[model samples]
Target: MHVLFLAPEVWPFKRVGGLAEVAYDLPRALAALGHKVGVVTPKPRLSQEMEQGLERLDTVLEVPVSWKRHLAEVYRHQEPSGVEVYLIGHEHLFDREGLYGNAYGDYEDNAERFIFYSRACLELARTMDWRVDVFHANDWTTGLVPVYLRTLYAGDPCLKDAASLMTVHNLGNQGQFWHYDMPLTGLGWEYFVPEALEFYGQINFLKGGLVFADMISTVSHTYAQEILTPELGRGMEGVLMARRDRLAAVVNGIDYQVWNPADDYRLAANYDRHDPSPKARCRQELMGHYGLEDGGGRPLVAVVGRLEDRKGLDLITAGMERFFEVGLNLVVMGYGEDHYHVALGELAARHPGRLGLTIGFDIDLAHRIMAGVDMLLVPSRYEPCGIHQMQALRYGVVPVVRDTGGLADTVVDQRPGVEGTGFKFEPFTMEAMLQTLDRAKQAYDRPQEWRGLMQRAMAQDFSWQAVAPRYEEIYRKALELAGQRQRA
Candidate 1:
């Protein structure tokens, strides 16, 4: 089977979140499984320096977006794993410092920019000799791929019969635009109804994909079910419930090659599940690097990723005093809302040595933290499928995640005869999180029990090798659905 992935970002070229990592690793995993795979993404300006081996293709695609025609330059790169990556370059649209926008906010033209890229994806596919059995669209940026496939290219030989799978990484970020911008979609105003692209008079790109795609999927089974409720749906629950039959979920996987502690060059000391004694050196280095005073034998807990409200930063802030009292040292990395920056900065200042904070993301620092931290905190209010928890597991850093979404699916709370990998709290409140942390600290004090938990986490597998087959199954089901739709 031949699968084509459409995403706004692909790792090592351009990345903003977990979607990029999924785009990077999943294709290669599928290719290794003996299926032909390809990826289509916009060429961000920064990728030029990173992708030195990129080949400029002779084919120039004239992509139509509403009333305008934009020419897209194609660049090709062949991965060692036999996956083809096609980057569509448009200087005026994509040659920006950031893939979506700068620090100020999201690009105002995000809707128009992605509409052109979605059209270009189909146009580029038309030029290729490869036949795509499934066009996998990721997130809101490429949501229009399925919409266009069913509308504009309905009669086209190459794409008409091809099924589409729209993967919603985060329903909260549905590409919503002003109603006036509906013209940019090149679809009839009739499609602007609530049954299709419309969301409270706004042109919702993700809604269109959900309505038109052969099948829809989210990152984890729990999240798939969560999005159908008013609490987590972000106003798309009714539409999702209307088409729940077509919805499916698979947990996101980590690329062990990139996450394995044994071979990670970024760590100060490398160790696997067999001999994790070297982790002590990594812990010492982490403490020294962050200027954190040694806590005698206190657990070094780290919170990694964006400091946003949904990430439960509020809970962490509320529980800071309790955390310090329980003999736990905390370090936080990743940047987000200004309020969180100020709040966390003030907290870190008020409690010097015990609390350490880094305002931005650093890949090397992330790796070192994974190896060094005794426990990783991922107290998200609602996580689609958290990659950090998976990475923490791979490094034998026990994850203390909220029992919601993918976190619930991945981490098993320790109980008698359970052999769990991590700790889980049910409610999204500071008290619940604190209680879980206290329990984790108790377990930590027991050296033999802690070692057993760490070894169990490392032994568990969440590799793409185990995940890609599930995608292949989804693709086949999508193909069957598309065939039935065509016949009808």
Candidate 2:
């Protein structure tokens, strides 16, 4: 099958979050399965070193947005994994310092920018004579791809028959813009009704995708169910529930090649599940780098990823004193929310050698932390699908994650006689998190049990190779639905 993926961010080119990583890895995984996979993303302002690799195409795509015609230049690059990447370049709209927005917040013209990009994706496919079987749209950024496919490009011979599958990475970001911006979509006001594009008094891009696309998917099975409820739905529950039959969940996968501890050059010393003694060297290096001292063999636990309230950073802050009293050393990485920065910094100062904090993301440091940390903390309030837990498991590092979404699906809670990989807490409370931490520490204190747990985690496989076939199955089902729609 020929699948063309449309996403706002693709790693190595532009990456703001997990969506970027998925865009890069999933297509490569699909290509490896002997299917033709192509990715279309907006070309942002990149470093000169990165830009040299792109081959600018002569074709100028005439994209219609609202009443005006916008011309877009295309750049092509063939990835090492044989996946073809096409970057739609629009200097005024996309050539910015940030992919979505700068430090101020989201770009004011975000709806307009993505509207142009979505239309350009179809134009690129048609111009290149690439017959796309499935136009897999990711998140609200490319949500209109499906809407445009069934509307504006419905009669176009090249793209008319292509099926669309819209994957919602997070329901919280629905791309709700002012109702007046409906004109920017170049669709009639009829689409602005409650049953279609309109949400409350705004134009909702994601809602349109849910209504128009043949099939919809999210990151994990549990999350697929979660979004149908009011709590996690973020006000899209009714639309999602109406199309519940069309919705499915496939847990996100990690690239084992990039995450394998035995082969990771970023680690202080390489080790696998079989011989994890080298992890001690990595642990020492990580501590030395952070100015943290080994606390008489206390288990070292680390929190990685964005430090926001949604990630249960509040729980971490609330339980910090108790966690330290219980003989646990803590290290934090990744940056988010200024309040967390100040709070965690103050805590680190108070605890001196016991607490270590790094305010931003560094890929090299991430690898070292994963390899060295005895336990990885992922107590999210609600996680769609977490990649960190999977990455930690691959490195023989046990995860202590909240029992929700993909974390619940991936991490098996350790119990007596259960061949569990890690620890889990159900309630989203600091007390629950602390209790789970105590259980993990108790297990860590028992060297034999801790080694068993680590080995069990490392043996688990959440690789893209194992996950790609499921996507293929969904694409086939989506094609079936498309055929039914065409017949009607």
How does each model score on lDDT?
0.91, 0.92
lDDT of 1 by residue, 250-351 (tens): 999999999999999998999999998899999999999888887688999999998898899999988898899988999999887889899889989998
> Could you tell me the lDDT of residue 269 within candidate 1?
94
Q: Give the best candidate by TM-score.
A: 2
Which ranges of candidate 2 are over 4 A from the true structure? Answer: none
Q: Please report, as a residue range, the 10-residue window in candidate 1 with the lowest summed lDDT.
A: 44-53
Q: What is the TM-score of each candidate against the true structure?
A: 0.97, 0.98
Per-residue alpha-carbon lDDT of model 2 for 1-488, expressed as tens digits?
99999998998898777888899899999999999999999999999998999999999999988998999999999999999999999999999988878879899999999999999999999999888999999999888899999998999999988999999998878888999899999999999999889888999898889889999999999999999999999988988898899898999999999999999999889999999989999999999988887868989998999899889999999899999988899989988888899999999989999999999888889999998899999999999998999999999989999998999999999998897999999999888888889999999989999999999999999999999999999999999999999999
Using lDDT as the measure, the top candidate is 2
RMSD of 1: 1.4
In terms of lDDT, model 1 sits at 0.91
Model 2 clashing residue pairs (backbone): none
